[model samples]
Target chain A: MPQGQPEVVPDDGLTTRQRRNRPLLAVHTGSMKGKSTAAFGMALRAWNQGWSIGVFQFVKSAKWRVGEEAAFRALGESGAGGPVEWHKMGEGWSWSRKRGTEEDHAANAREGWAEIARRLAAERHDFYVLDEFTYPLHWGWLDVSEVVRTLRERPGRQHVVITGRYAPEELLDAADLVAELTKVKHPMDAGQKGQRGIEW
Target chain B: MPQGQPEVVPDDGLTTRQRRNRPLLAVHTGSMKGKSTAAFGMALRAWNQGWSIGVFQFVKSAKWRVGEEAAFRALGESGAGGPVEWHKMGEGWSWSRKRGTEEDHAANAREGWAEIARRLAAERHDFYVLDEFTYPLHWGWLDVSEVVRTLRERPGRQHVVITGRYAPEELLDAADLVAELTKVKHPMDAGQKGQRGIEW
Candidate 1:
């Protein structure tokens, strides 16, 4: 070896080091069918793979809605055990109903969105699900461009999943995968009634 | 009985139905989260209660994303067996993605939304969940006010669930329930690995 030669590093350490790759996933469902259920299945698959997950449901408040916490706990209790943390939009639908001043509602929505964005940026969850994110854009409560930009700028190797009927084109374009559910024939067409464990 | 009294019918040949007191549920999860699983659970609960149901999804093209048919089958296979049908948005998301072509995207989105509105107005289903409804809004692909008005004008005892992050205040105001999930902790924070069954 030359006197001035630098010591060569062993390849073992380099090979053993883990590579991080975070993929953004957007699941767009067309209609009332089963988009949510499908998204859940995919998440379950991911969770089963030993990945820690972060769950977010937009446009949701704990007052009138059945909380995802119950559902998450139920999922865990049903033998789909794993450590899953949940983050929820807390203001509920007060803005949509015009229950409060526009300023108040706007403030709440902004606060909620900021929290979501912060979490998305700060955490390194293996998976992040933004549930019902499209409504803000649909109702003119949030800027779509900002959302797209934020999603594009998300840090870490976390995988993102979005589910809803009308996904914006920008989001779909940026998405690696998109799934749409269509309506063909339905029971209501034939006057059949919706039953429990089937239509809830 | 008085001679002028009308006969009291026990059941006007219509099946006794229970009103669905539950709020409509919509979920948006990016990419590969368990949205479908959650939808399936909700559907199953509603189905067991004897309510008519309808399902639809928006697809840009037949070849693009996973079709609603597969999702329905998967949900059903996962024990959500019920009378659920899937519909496609027909127009894909690509047309909306093209910049400077707002008219085309709007037209397609309107057409798709018209179909949804028609179904909602028909009041055939007690619960309606628009999976990716926010995409069109985010892309400037659809008119948010129009969609909200249509939903607000929907008749009967129908409960609607619109899931997606970034829902506007107008839509949120129109909703009876709103939920937002915030992320607190995650496994990826410490560099844990993601596997197939857990993070798919």
Candidate 2:
């Protein structure tokens, strides 16, 4: 009332401070050997704890691949409280020789990552996982420092898990815990073909 | 007279020869910074050369944010020609607040990655970018050595790109090109908020 524009009254009555209670958990794996399975189990456990969760696939192009989407569907169908929203990379893979232009690819990647960041901010998930995030960093499609900064800046007590082969030392330093996977043998080495359900 | 189980027929009409094409140009950006954007641009450039491309987001959980998915979609729509398929991580981020009987997270991660590997094997792409592949290695979800061997053993002249923050030095040594995105300045420091379609 004193000023030309009435001072905007802070809606303290309507505003309820959101309690940041979740922990940021980074799960960095060495290889793809058993990552999917392990990730799934951990997600289920968290879901059982009544934690709202968000799932994301960092670098995947195929619609039919039964990795992230399948797991969510199965869990939701198996009585998980809510369905896990799935997001897939539209560009199947960026290594095609027929690509049109660099700007096009950069724009695409930027859009894809922007979408992911938006969801992370909007949703009130207790846990957020950045899957195969290393690819973007490795390919130079995403800025690693920016990503790390985003992770560090994400508000709330949300636990973030990053799965991939190599986690930057900086990320590891920032992480509360770090685990490494080493492979001694695999069926492929014995000339056996990958099996569905078991392998896939 | 035919021998038991049909005499092993050695193909005389067809000559078994390998094509000596340029080795698949694979780039891995371990440091974060702008690696994702760089990878996307590089991939798009490679695509313009009329080479079939495959992009794999090794970690499936990190891309859940809306910003991340939108980036990929934009890329696909930007006349890159052909669809960019994304393999999503259905399970939310993997973290064990409480331990259980089974190795759930590991199992889920493995399944998703196996699916990706299967697709890579079946599809014929000129370039394959494995995004955020390092998490699997750090988490003990996948086999590092085995993955390296498989990548080395892949057929065709397909180029591979692996991006992550902490790529093993061994991988860097083996790679044809290795880049690290170092962090210098970030918007977070300036108090600039993450804008939609800008920072994902």
Candidate 3:
């Protein structure tokens, strides 16, 4: 509610209310933490609005089982808000429990992107979270220009958020909102390691 | 789960496992969004870990209930995870639905701080989110030194996170992890007004 006022108002012809309702292509990209966490937070808000949610994790291991996945799974099943579907395109596509080669990982990442592209075309979900998605683009596994083009031309009123570090300039240019998390200080700097509840 | 490795490891006598389990005092601040959102996301992790969670909002209006409140309340009641308690020390302490004078707001903020301090002393919650607490310290409504000292001396392995803009120097100095979210760009920058679900 304390969200700041717009510093610049564009002359886009649309009324304020109409402009405000437009779907956002948000990017959470930076070297620090909370990129995916913030995206998940936004998904929580979208869910509260009764928007169907889809989350695709690109980097984290499926065996790790992050907290957002479990809580969202429960929230979706609770029948109190919107439906949630979580997909783990984990490191090497860990769902198969097989370690893959470099080419195999690249192929899997491309397959994951293709699935997301199909979903966007079909307008299957109101809100989609491509959690840690930038890695594939950064690693040159996914074509950045093509990804940007698909997102820019996404059909219907679906909101999509992409998160991870080193987001390609093309993707950032296409995104309507981008939040960069910078690390001022980290416990790791003081020899403290990540804890169970705090980090994951 | 994709959290990066520590660039530097200290010889602090504590084993890696012991250091990894240390409690964190995290601060999320700067002139951007996702401060409170990221904090709530971390709370989601804490909940999944079955930690008792307490959220005290120092700035957001209680009347304009944020989506996190509803979702967390649901999670707390569902008996599937941790217990959660949410307190809104809204603008003018709006729980009373009275627009208070400047002095009244200051007193209410002080009262809120005292409550948190007491809870810290009692080890009331395993995870604590002091949402938007820096404004009071920045506005001189609360003592920064005392607040920092209390958090530094909090009992047990409680993890505390404070979120807002312009965090006080002493608090930042004492914090274990500090994340400054820089707004690369926002829909607001393009004149889009805040909407119901996405903004709140």
lDDT of 2 by residue, B67-158 (tens): 33333343344443334444434333223223233346566556656655665577566666566666666676788777676676666566
Clashing pairs in 3: none
Under CAPRI classification, how is model 1 graded? incorrect
lDDT of 2 by residue, A154-196 (tens): 7656666666776666666666434443333333332233332
* Candidate 3 structure quality by residue, lDDT tens digits, B51-131: 999988887467444788888988888777899988877655433444454446677888889888988999999999999
Q: Number of clashing residue pairs in every model? A: 127, 147, 0
- Measured with C-alpha atoms, the lDDT of residue B62 in candidate 1 is 39
By DockQ, the best candidate is 3
Per-residue CA lDDT of model 1 for A1-200, tens digit only, reads 00112134333333212422335455555765555555554555555544566776664444312323444434443344345666555534322343343445455566667766776788657777667766665666778789889888887666787877577777776675566654433334333344334343
- The superposed Cα distance between candidate 1 and the true structure at residue B101, in angstroms, equals 61
Candidate 1 vs 3: which has more DockQ: 3
Candidate 2 deviant stretches above 4 angstroms = A1-22, A63-68, A77-79, A90-106, B1-200
Candidate 1 residue-wise lDDT, B1-200, digit = tens: 00112123233355435322223334344332333344434543444344454555443443322322343333333342334545545534322353334435456666667777877877767656565566676666777888888777777766555555566666666654443433222233333334334333
Stretches of model 3 off by over 4 angstroms after superposition: A2-5, A91-103, B2-5, B63-65, B91-103
| Native contacts, share recovered per candidate | 0.17, 0.00, 0.71
Best by lDDT: 3
